[model samples]
Target: MDETVKTPVRSFDIHDILKCLPHRYPFLLVDRIIEAHGDQSCIGIKNVTMNEPQFMGHFPGHPVMPGVLLIEGMAQTAGAFCIQAQERAPDAPPPLIYFMTIDKAKFRKPVVPGDRVEFHIERTNRRRNMWWFKGRALVDGQCVCEAEFSAMLVDTPTA
Candidate 1:
């Protein structure tokens, strides 16, 4: 009998994103991670659509992807980065990524339905359990949003 073993991928699809991050459904902003270089940086993708819950109320007729959600997407991307950066056993529990800080956030363009947003994140600094990253959300090679953010990786708590 011959069997093929699928090598574990460092880059993430939606399923892998689900496994790495705790978010789901309307909350899971990142659709896929197209690129990741060790723990240094990554690029996450989000396919925006009219069905997203936020579109219902953000503006009745004009649907603009919220800036906060863009930040959230970037944070989720960072979460995946934190997971990929660490060396963990196959059965090891996944760590929870927590937002520490956000600075220098600016929205230069509006992201709307049908826009495929690419979030590019680069690690700026790492100390102890926290990591600082610079992120930019782009559509069609134009910057939509940019921010500097930090997050901490923590072991899941036991009850």
Candidate 2:
């Protein structure tokens, strides 16, 4: 009998997101996943707020979401996709997704507190344990940031 079991694709709430990725408060960026396609794409939501640590120094009094964090949020969305993919095989080892490279990054507008950022990420390529994705962050349907990035899925190192 086969020991491997494939995990299915599904939506994620904050609790679910926590289970899929290893990030926590202050660094955990994604608020929830609205939809996801098997190893293909994911759409996630982020609720920005003035209380977020970055805003305290990123530019006090004029809170703006850092471009890097926007990219990070996009990356997190991709990470969730990878986690869901691994679920497809129950016996498959849980993999840690690492940001490998980022390119073609563009920030079109400043993201401010109270903005609901939507990260739209789609797989571009996958070779072995490495995967490439194109991502975009939008607010009110307007693009605020976009980039192409790659990540590697590997077995978590023993402590």
Candidate 3:
């Protein structure tokens, strides 16, 4: 008889995300993460609002979440997942994750205000402290954007 151990799915709220990532407001894109399975995959939610700073200059009359920001959101979501999945010493500082590459990025539709954008990310590969992910930004269950990206995790420098 063979018994397989399964990793339990985890979820992260804004506070938990704050602990995992270093991003703050005006840049922090993911509002929450759900169905996270030990960095294998996770779905991140971002609520687009008219009050966002980008709307002020992105367009004078119309407000649309920029495609670049969408990609950044995907990267942030993946970064948070990588951090949360790792094991570290209790006193160790959170690792700093840097965006390394964005590839095969395609924008299908413009993300607008009031849209609840969900970033679905799946890990494709991982080497040492680097990880690669395939991500899709969806709105109301429809795909709005997709991309493949990579990030590297580095330890924080001691003061």
Candidate 4:
């Protein structure tokens, strides 16, 4: 017999991120961005689970979500903000923004299975095509990870 259980995924559901970004399974961290405040800030959601591949080696009996993956989730959420910002502008043209630097990074609590990581980020600064952002990952309203990062929005040559 073949069977599968499909859990409801709205806050942690949006799969369009796979198409919008280059990240894939295991690396594809973010589940959805439920709220956005223009180019100012955004809120993304990630649902942690025991089924995640990293759980196997991160710890055999005890599983803990890696801080780096959490940061990636935050940065990716910022990338989405940049993408949405560009989409809002008529003359911005098609492009991709690459993360350049992350500073003042901090990891607080341990994120385990069944925890919903709410990623929040705010635009700190922007100049020309370069953008700077402050990001944080939270669980139950407590900070888990935070970082300050910069990115460049580049225009690709017409194909």
Candidate 5:
């Protein structure tokens, strides 16, 4: 007889993302976390549309999704994964994740409205409450941007 245990895959929709992240409205770049494996990796999706506020002035006629926002979406995906992986008390407040560092960022192509950007993030290292991740942003299965970033998770202070 053989015995094995497998970790179930987790996924988060917009509502679940709202509970895991502090971002809201125009700043909430991630639309859904399609797959998560423990705290090691996850893939998030963002649907770009012309109605977004950034398109107003980012370019008068040619709108491109800012590279910085792509990086932010990556961070948010990893942050949400970390929060979801934590083993906390039922009544505990969600920890706050702060973007600490961004490195090796590169933009390969422009992401425009109607493009569905996918944020692929993988945890490269972790210590205490700090984590490091390498991420790539892809559109139509082509790499649009890539970066390595770190974040720190802080417990929410009680009032």
Candidate 6:
């Protein structure tokens, strides 16, 4: 007999993310996540705007999104994956994911103002505390950046 299986999709609003990550506005590259599957994968959103500080001098006449921000966005998505994965386990406090390696990073195109950058990441492997992920960022369905990175899961200590 075949059993029907469904992997529930979890959503995280800005408030939920704030609790998971120690980042604030102007630095919080990821806005929200529409779908999350613990340590497997996730889809995230980032609203870009001209009001961002880097736009001031990133280009005198033209404002271009920085590559570092793109990587940060991916990192945020990976962080979300780790956080959701831990919550799905038996019972646990908050988990803090830290970037261990960021490799094969490439910037293919320019992400400008008024653009909504979407990020998709999948966990390739998770051993003990380290997690490996392959991620890509897209704007208007066009790839803007892509990379493979690894991070460590460090649970926050409870009092």
Which structure is stronger by TM-score: 1 or 5? Answer: 5
lDDT of candidate 1 over 1-159, digit per residue (tens): 659654343678898887788888979999999988778888999999999999999777999999999999999998887797788897777889999999999999999999999999999999988999999999999999999999999997766
Worst 10 residues of 6 by lDDT: 85-94
| Model 6: per-residue Cα lDDT over 50-105, one tens digit each | 99998999986899999999999999977975776674455555677788999999
Which residue pairs clash in candidate 3? none
Cand. 6 Cα-lDDT: 0.87
Candidate 3 lDDT: 0.93
| Candidate lDDT (C-alpha), each | 0.90, 0.90, 0.93, 0.81, 0.94, 0.87
TM-score to true structure, per model: 0.92, 0.89, 0.96, 0.82, 0.95, 0.90
lDDT (10s digit) by residue, model 3, range 1-38: 76987779999999989998989998999999976989
What C-alpha lDDT, on a 0 to 100 scale, does residue 118 get in candidate 4? Answer: 92
Q: Model 1, poorest ten-residue lDDT window?
A: 1-10
What tens digits encode model 4's per-residue C-alpha lDDT throughout 12-101?
A: 236546545666787878889887777788889999999999999988899999998998899888876567666545653446668899
- Winning candidate number (lDDT): 5
List clash counts for every candidate, in order.
0, 4, 0, 0, 0, 0
Error of 4 at 103 (Å): 0.6
The digit string of per-residue lDDT tens for model 5 on 1-159 reads: 657766678899999899889899899999999999998999999999999999999886999999999999999999998899999998788899999999999999999999999999999999999999999999999999999999999998889
Q: By the TM-score metric, which is better: model 3 or model 6?
A: 3
